[model samples]
Target: MSIKFWRSLPFQTGFSIALGAVLLTLILSIAVYNQTIEKVVTDSNHRISQLISTIERSASIAAYLNNDELALDVTRGLVKNDIVTGVSLRSESGMRIISGSPFNFKEESILHFPLASPFMPDEKTGELFIKPNQQNIDAQAKQMGALLVFTLATHSLMITIFVIFLVQNRLTRHLTDLANTLHKIEPGSAERLQCPTLHRHDEIGLLVRDTNQLLTAVQNTLAGERRLREYTETLEKETRKEAERDPLTNLLNRRAGERAISRALDKADTNNTRCAIMLIDLDRFKPINDTYGHDAGDHTLVTISNRLTDALRKNDIVIRWGGDEFLILVQQGHDDLQISVIADKILATLSVNIDINTSIQESIGASIGISLYPDHGTDPSYLFDLADKAMYHIKRSGRNGYFIHTPSDTA
Candidate 1:
């Protein structure tokens, strides 16, 4: 799972808090309980040592005064020490003087007298032996047991409440705020998460700081995407505009003619009709531009352009074919004679005097080439080629005239 997802989970957050608290509490409790158990064991051993000292003193006094009954009372009292589970009194001659509990005599009791001490005293002096009080230890065990239960209950209750409050007030609120912030983000709107400022120097604060940093990165990403989208739209629009224009003439170019011709072809071909592709070339246009100024040539071309449009149908397309040439696409019925008639009409239209500049009103004429679909050629390119060849043939034969394309001319 992602860090964000794990951080957002309520159970995981609570579990983390509880785990930390439990670990700390266990370490502390173990240390304290070990010390308490050691103190109890030490105190119990001290009480046993004092009882053995009193019994030895009483035994010495009884032997010195020759008081048998008082010595018996001292021995009985020595047996009464609650922690002393077993006891024995042995004389210097290795004879057993007294025994307590079930055993009459045992080697372990004798071993305890020496084992309980680090170093035995003078060889002649008697010593005292002590054992642990199982019953009293049992009572202390019950008490420690109760204390342990109380400590665990108190610590667990406090820890549970603390973890619950920490998760609810800190983690849950932060995650919920983050979720709401994410929900508010819009595709184009300039908005972002505004996490509330916190004063506590804790993990949650660190988490909030990191979250804000991440949101900042997200905001930058969104902004960049919006800019890219806008740039793409503008580029697309400019590309579309460029596609419709003629680079040289600054008019609707060959691309426009193709679109118009395709539509016209679709309509004319449906009814088994025909369309005429008229290729018009300006006569002596290169010489005019070379002798005069290019500006004057361009103005002449523009003048000729206007004349051509005035002579043709409104539906007819007039396209600038690069330098000093234009293409006129016209829809016509199945009549080859009509194509010739339109060519004549165009010739007559251009025969008039055209004002090139303020002082010069020159005569500009065109060599017309005609190509008909399903008669001249079947395809658009072939028909365009046929008309182009015819225009070249007319130019080769003589300037300022017209010609119709034939299949043999193409070969």
Candidate 2:
């Protein structure tokens, strides 16, 4: 069990009150029982002493007269009281004049009194022996002990109940209400406690007010954090988009193109499929750039990029590799025919006349080189290199054409 569970105000209050009452009752009961026993024993002893004192004159006369009947009567009278278990009288000559029945001489201490002679004052006659009854004392002590236990138990129960009631009202109820309110409170929400006790000047009220303040602060902090997070996310998206796009063509740049090729290679490896890497280079593009200027060249590249994007499958990715150079990644390419068809479309699209100005018009073409993943090489760098080499081969043979790299071509 958690400490908080056990430390609940109601439970702690009840347990402490109950345990303290029980312990107090136990200690006091034992103390009172012992003290009562001692008092009973002491009073019995005093009573026995007083009874002997009252009968001292009679016992002295009986001893002086050498009267056996009188001594027997004295002993009998003493024994009648339950506290006096046994009694005996002795003469000056060491003769036992009288003794009660069942008298055991070996018992505890025998109360001894000197018998004075009536004829001669200050002269000794004999002694009287009395044995106090222990059983009677124990019986009285037991009775008092039972009564003490009953009294203590009654008081303990009453005190426990009263303490529990007092603590519940004073502390436990308020704490319980506070705990329930806190439990219902959700961080970063508009939820708040409606406790009227918060207006009080007590510590509990202060605590409640402070807790609500803390919650309000937390809600504000969380809301601000959420807004900040949302703004940060929007900015990151824009930044990433700007980083990955070419300024002129608005197509994927070389960095994004590398990432796309890596993703494509991973997909191809997983699906056991092939993809094509096509490198496209414009034919006779330098002459136009030198004649009409770089703005016209930029415009031409943007035009070609749009046409290529429209002509290829939606799954294919086109990137502006560098000035006047473009790269395309074709997904799920089945054969050379699939790759060649897309390359042919790009060449035909670029072959159309582009309007550089109202008074000027120019025509351009693109040479495309294709390489297959796991056919040319599994690595993207190796495949791109093969495609570049094949594009150069096309440029060497003739411009505005496409060629697929093969081992036989190198031979």
lDDT of each: 0.69, 0.85
* Model 2 C-alpha lDDT per residue in residues 123-147, reported as the tens digit of each score: 9998888887888889999898879
What's the residue-level lDDT of 345 in candidate 1? 86
Candidate 2 regions off by >4 Å? Answer: 1-26, 49-71, 88-97, 101-130, 150-243, 269-274, 332-340, 355-361, 372-383, 393-398, 403-411
Best lDDT goes to which candidate?
Answer: 2
In candidate 1, which residue ranges exceed 4 Å CA deviation? 1-24, 46-69, 77-81, 89-99, 102-130, 142-146, 149-157, 160-189, 197-248, 252-275, 283-296, 307-317, 330-353, 357-365, 379-381, 389-411
What lDDT is obtained when candidate 1 is compared to the true structure?
Answer: 0.69
Give the TM-score of each candidate: 0.62, 0.69
Candidate 1, residue 322: the lDDT equals 65
Model 1 C-alpha lDDT per residue in residues 1-411, reported as the tens digit of each score: 134656566767677777776776676667666666666676777777766665665555443444546445665676776766665444343423343564433443232332121133233323334446657766775578559746875878697877778767766777676666757666445565555566236665666567667767777888899899999999998887788877545556887777777778778788677788989998867876886788878877777777778888777778886677788888764454388778888988777776666877777788988888768766888888888889988888886888888877643
Task: For candidate 2, list the clashing residue pairs, or say none.
Answer: none
